[model samples]
Target: MTAEEETRTAAPAERLWDLAGRWHGVAVAAGILVLTRVVQILLLVGLDRAIPDPAGLRSNLLIWDGGWFQRVAAGYPQGYTYAQNGALEGNELAFFPLYPMLIRALSAIGFDPGSAALAVSWLASLGAAVALHLLGTSLFKSRRAGWALVGICCGAPMSVVLSMAYSESLFLALVAGMLVAAHRRVWWAAGLLGLGCALTRPTGAAAAVALAVAALVAIREHRDEKKWPPLVAAAVALAGVPAYLGWVGWRVGEVDAWFKIQTAGWGTSFDFGDSTIGFLSDTLTLADGWVPMSVALILLVALAAAGVALAGRPWLPLAVYGIVAMILVYGQAGYYHSKPRLLLPVLLTLLPAAAAAARARPRVAILAISAWAAFGLWYGAYLVAVWPYTI
Candidate 1:
């Protein structure tokens, strides 16, 4: 290893202190997320006082997916239903378990299911921010870039979901933590975190792929990284996705029941963007679909920018992971309206842009964040109080 690489990898007491002090940026990021969510509540509740769906701002976080997760946590006694009213019913088993399990555990302690779910997301989002900061600092070799990455990530227009009862924050925390552990060559932590990720979301497979690739490359480059944990992580990653699917299938009494749950229950399946293109085409002729279309289009532009930024970049693992995740997301055709929310997991795509902003002046970063916050408040309110799409 080069002297500089050795210096970075072998951190002494001063580096540890610096690392601890640098958490100030994480504090700012967390505060920003809290303030953003607060603004969202203010706008949503103030604008639509007569709308009583969610009942109140505190309860609002459990509106859409939160309702599903809470129902799942409630045991989903109804179980899988292929159809209701002669159409796809969206079974509760279609929802993943870790988030709901967390909510259930919290509810066991006297918290309302909705509030518990929201608390999981809120706390997980902050944890994810800290992990993202560490991963960014390691990858970019600049504390400014790390802080900027945190700001940019939480500033994503849909970041309001970070504070809701969604699993995105929890999944992100695991993913970011896995990335940091791998970067630090903490093989055991990486393996265990990868297992945590495997249990969290399907995208965990993408992370496993990226990490394995990095590990293999490190071996080829004679970096002296361990060999076994990567294999174990990959095994967990490969097995974990199937384990949940298989269990759901077995519980439902059909070997292909998991895929059926996605199709017959929720109408979700791979369509290679045909459904997406069709949705976009229909958007021009339909009035009611405009909001979802606008959201998807804006996200498309951002994704395109991210693709451009990541092309030819040096961060192979992150790029591969982000690209693979995006491919899987875009390949799926069902539920076109939720595309933006679906893309939230592949956030490494934003690193190139965030790093550039970090290289700019502090005011530039402030302006970028300010603009996103202004628009995010409106977008977040729309999601909470108005939009019908399940985020």
Candidate 2:
């Protein structure tokens, strides 16, 4: 090659190398995400042999809630959805708009709906891993902790949703980003990311509350200044969930239309943990299947783990977010198996594991995470491939 040509080729490579060097932690986090995804996808493929679906195993990624998201992306209903007998039915409106809107925007660029949905989810998952790494590093001041956080989260049970046509990936990305911004006292970014989280999922309310706590902490520390930025950020975040809910009500001509739809369609409502307790009781005592028993056990372990995390005295904003998110997941009456998926982003439960892994030797950390990824990936794959229920 000519000298000019060699310079051109090497310059791009050099720049890429420089970029990677500057963001090595992020690169590691991304690698962890990719590793977990590969393991999970392979597990799903292996499970396909036992499940035997005409549409193939990959199709399972878009089953259940994915269908709802796709429907919403196609277009939301102009009014309430009702069953043939005139009963209120769960409609596309029950699904959040941010994810579907992203899918639609991607589709407009000429990709098919399924491809677009997956594309949006995968991209958001990447963003999530990066944001999570930043959050961990910012809070703990350790790159190892950041990487551990990414690995634990991506390899978490039901983390397959990160690769699915679901909004959990987007929600996680926004929530993590918001927390990172809040911890860094970047109020503008925090406020916008918090708003995004609120629009993406109902649990965003918990996140907003967490942001408010962070703001209060900041205000107390700077009592003389009376920082308006923190106050404004909290207010902006607090407005998101209510704004979306109100818009839904206005669109459907009933103030409670969204709640009614959720209850009718998914049997989801806050019951002060009554249903969860009942499920745990039955599953522990007389459960017919191992999956139910396992789920029940996970719920208990998660609660205990969160308690331990609190005892460790994590950053206040993160603790608040984790506790409130857990409340929303456990206090609701709904499909019991789905709780783990919702809990995946609850940093509180993951904190104990992540911190332990961070402190361990590299070989030990890798082995522990490998074992965890093996079971978590398999469990998630089994839920979608063979569980025969909407997760």
Indicate which candidate wins on TM-score: 2
Compose the digit string of candidate 2's lDDT tens values, residues 1-391. 6797557535633443343334786788899999898888888878877755534655888888888888899999988878889988888988878999998999999989988999999999999999888877777667777888899889888898998988999999999999988876778899999999999999999999999999999899867544888889999999999998898999999998889889999999999999999999888889769999999989999999999999999999999999899989999999998999999888889888888987999999989988888888999998887788888
Q: Residue 304's C-alpha lDDT in candidate 1?
A: 81
Q: Residue 74 error for model 2, in Å?
A: 1.6
- In model 2, the Cα lDDT at residue 160 comes to 89
Leading candidate by lDDT? 2
**TM-scores, each model vs. reference:** 0.89, 0.93
For model 2, what is the C-alpha lDDT against the true structure?
0.87
lDDT of each: 0.73, 0.87
lDDT of 1 by residue, 1-391 (tens): 7897567556632353365346576676567666776777787787557565555676667777888888989985434674436754567878777888899999999998888998899889888877777777777766677777777777676777887788889988888887777666666677777767777777887888877876665566755645675667656655776788788877878777667777775578878877766776677557456576676676567678666767747477777788878877777767665677767768766777777777889898889877867886777667766665565
TM-score of model number 2: 0.93
Clashes of each: 1, 0
TM-score of structure candidate 1: 0.89
